[model samples]
Target chain A: MTHIIFDLLHILDEAGIDQPVAGNVISERLGISRTAVWKYVNLLREVGYVIDASAKTGYTLRKRTWLLLPYEVKRYLKTKVIGQEMHHFEQVPSTNALARQMMHEVGDEVQPGTVLIAEQQTGGLGRMNRVWMSPEGGIWATIVVMPKLHVDQIFLITMAASISLARAIRHEFELSALIQWPNDVFIGDKKVAGTTLELAADEDIIKYCLVGIGVDVNVSVEKVMPNLSRLVTSLSDELGHDVDRAQLFSVFLKEFERRYQMMLKGESEPLFREWRSLSRTLHRRVRVRTIRESFEGEALDVDERGALIIHKDNGEIERVIAGDCYLI
Target chain B: MTHIIFDLLHILDEAGIDQPVAGNVISERLGISRTAVWKYVNLLREVGYVIDASAKTGYTLRKRTWLLLPYEVKRYLKTKVIGQEMHHFEQVPSTNALARQMMHEVGDEVQPGTVLIAEQQTGGLGRMNRVWMSPEGGIWATIVVMPKLHVDQIFLITMAASISLARAIRHEFELSALIQWPNDVFIGDKKVAGTTLELAADEDIIKYCLVGIGVDVNVSVEKVMPNLSRLVTSLSDELGHDVDRAQLFSVFLKEFERRYQMMLKGESEPLFREWRSLSRTLHRRVRVRTIRESFEGEALDVDERGALIIHKDNGEIERVIAGDCYLI
Candidate 1:
């Protein structure tokens, strides 16, 4: 029903601004009720779409708001559902937190490709209970993914997301972007974006996963953490101009869709290759802190499960499934 | 403060059951006021510990309710907090679902050892979204664990839990119990208990995990799934009599504490040894269904991460991190 209305609106939008087509013409072209066309226009207005209407002067597209409405997103989206049904919030504690709540409320009914977007996050959380700074003008969003992968391969989702972000940033501004191990998008040794993934699953299978992404789109370094300010950089800061958030988001969605499909198909070698190509942690001298002990080594490669294979100074290799990785 | 009260109560309990000790005697022995001793006895009563009190008779230990009250559990608990502060529900969807909700409501303020227990579950969940039969007289509990281990090693916790349950049953009932790979606890090929673990973590560090355990303690197989009537058995059915839930819970707690401590200290080798010794899945041809694909292989061994390492017929070894393992 919604799709039909959207199709009508798209047809009307393509009819050009100066040309006002009659109801008879539209009905003859699309075989829908004239009243139905009028109802859809009113519905679009109720949802913040300014469509000019009249008896003689048919519908005219006025201002296009950058609100992440489902209709607006779907117009540009090419993927299945990731980021298709967006929950836009002006202010939220955290997109991840809201996504988690929504996951429970919706349960299995959660639409695949549902995106939770927040303009600002007051209590944005990072890994290990650390606070993620999500000020205004930043892309603070979480994407729900129902990937058909084993729990071990779950890390590939995050890897794909990181690669997607890196690809999007590179494509938009032609900047030299690199990916940090796990899920941080870096630009010339400084972090520009980060992601935290939370999976809802039992011992045997992953039910769902929420990939929370925070990109420093237009935010300045002073807005982020003081300690991280030196290491983190923003797109606007890098390019000396503000990037279009809507455009970046659409690009990210498209890239994420391609990568996610590959991941779901168990075609991770290509994604892993792309990730490795963009990763700065690999071949870099790094120190990893596990719970029991800490080890310093050179990162050799990442395995299929996304475990870091580190070559120690003693000619031994360690496969680190989980640990805090620090570039020394 | 609660600890001091329980200590005094323990002393009074050990004094005599028939002859009640006078408040003056307790005050003198514990070096506190008679009024304080009276207050402590009232507190114990509030926590479901039935103490018969009289003017001249003083206080006599009659019977203690096996309720998992915070004070009662804290008094006897040896671990940090896993089951010390239990939030119990008579009927809930699932202990794990409740735990996840509580984790969000309380956020990081949730103590590590907090546990959620349900008497009867309306939507008791098992691995792969299977319906877990949690009728009355069954143990439906979720224990919160904040282990400083790698995300991969998190599986060892489940392994340890199964080992703990098997050992508890063996020690308490002198019955031969075994573990089916991944989650199920069995007795002589008949499944008796099962567990589900949910992890909330970042790529590097795991924030917390909820281990939801369901044991057919005193419930008959008839109370469970009709299909499992011939295959499944309960503790009561195995023992030919009803089992005291409180005693069984205590035994499980003690055994869990031992294994949990061992796991925390990086002593998973013994846990794996015990799991191997008590496992029914080993040396069997099994079909593993992961989300991506299905494969058949001989169950070789459970590695350190508690992943079932299967040696396929094609001479390739597959480390299944998460999947439904079915014996063929």
Candidate 2:
């Protein structure tokens, strides 16, 4: 179903926006019935897409009110495969939910760089079971990667993704970005973006990993959850101008591809070094929450396995492989 | 659908060997069609069952099969929830495949102790992208565990399961079972069983963990894959007798529940101790295989994080959090 939608989008892209093109032309181009093309056009309109139609003319792309469509985002994309196969939804409970479903159905057959993107998520999730507010214009995407790496080394992929987002922010808008341990891409003391890494992994091997990332690209701080409103900021809010989300998404996928290739080749040392250089949590006073207990400490460094090393105030050093780290 | 099967099984159990008199009465009592009852009976017979059915009479159990049916296995069961909700398939690509599907559809509403069992798996999986053989009489079951623990501690659940299997084999058959590091359950230095832990988790929190366990019970060594035939042994082969698989499964689920409760309460130290005690890899010469490289060392101990600590020949110690460990 998503493939058919993409096919229609491709036909529309080829038809161009000069004038309304007939359904027969789209049908012939996509190798589908005219009725099927008309159905898809209606679906696009229902999802906030405005298409101008006339008896003599075909369909004109008047306005694209929907966000994160592959046709719109793929224009600036420059990568081998990432984001090449995208599943876009107007309103989904979560992109990760759909990505997980697709990953199970296809398993390792889901090519690396395949992405699941959604405009708005009703049940958007953050790491540690927290809810992420994914309003319209916010980027909710999960990329499927088959690194064929060990389960522990999988964390390196997450670090690479964080670095990609940080680098993209710096290069595109000249905004200084900081990375919180594990997955968040932050700006100064406030969070501008967050990421969650979910895996369909066994003990020794990872079948596939879903790197679900949510960025406050064009979301207003006021529109975010009230509890998180004070702690979070958006790229649009920080830049004092609304950024083009499609362009931002393209930059992220490209950066992600470069880092992901390095990771697959086991060249994560440079990526980790770059990550450390941009990381703000290390060497800062912080508190770490594990299921067993919570501890206050000064963050030291992240080990090769991506475990956070913390030097506690009580003179004890703790290696935290998994937990929530909050900067004090 | 599974709940209905269990209810019907309970009614059949109560009907006993009194054939016509009890079977007809029970079928009518349950308000189900008599042909539907007979169909369930025929279904059981097709799967290696040896029930005595007469046209003028009803069904009588002449002999119990070694199949892992809920009715047959749950007779001696003792667990709060681990195997309470059962799903049995005659042939599936993988039990993990079915469990992953159920996890999505059921979400958090999935009952704890839910078991997905399959008789034959065409595409059974092992750790690190290996294939697991699931022929008839071998146990292919995945138990859904919802533990309110940090994602890092999730490995402890796997460790505890290995310990439980080891203890169950030792107590039930008086066999000296040894646990290989991470997953494989062994007997006399040969692989007798194996386990794979799949998680729907992020860095800090675990949504659920599906512990897919495959034990070569009551299976002939000649039936196994040629490459693995020599390296593996079954409980039947080890004991030199056809062990009752239903009884063994009941004992394992009972033991698993006890250990799982301890893990959920953050009491993994005792479970870890038991794992070390039962482990054959500890203090033994072994080789650990990771994606980067393979290293030879003497297994020292498993840390609190369930990572294997290996002391190299050069006196350097390596902490392997996730990998394939083989006895050398």
Top TM-score hit:
2
Q: After TM-score superposition, what is the CA distance of residue A220 in candidate 2 from its true location, in Å?
A: 67
Kindly list the per-residue Cα lDDT of model 2 for residues B152-256, writing each as its tens digit.
Answer: 787888887888898888889999999998888988768998889998876678878999889998888876666777789999888777888888888999999
| DockQ, Cα level, model 2 | 0.01
Candidate 1 lDDT, A1-328, residue by residue in tens: 1356667666766785445656556656667655445545544554456666555555676755444445555666677667766666656788887778655533444678778778788999876667888887789999988875678788899898999999999998899888878778989978899888899887758888998888999877765566777878899888887766777887898999899999888788899899999998999999999878798999989998888999987889999887778889
RMSD of candidate 1 to the truth, in angstroms, is 33.8
Off by over 4 Å in 2: A1-328, B1-12, B15-23, B32-40, B54-58
Q: Go through the candidates in order and give each one's C-alpha lDDT.
A: 0.77, 0.79
Candidate 2, residues A1-328, lDDT tens digits: the string is 2457667766666676655677667778778655445546655654556776554566788776446777778889998878887766666788888677555433434567788788888999999879888898789999988778899898888898899999889999998998999789989879988889988767788878889888998877876666677788999889887888888889999999999999888898898899899998999999999989999999999999899999999999999988989999
Question: Interface RMSD, all models, one decimal each?
Answer: 27.9, 21.7
Query: What TM-score does chain A of each model score against the native chain A?
Result: 0.80, 0.85
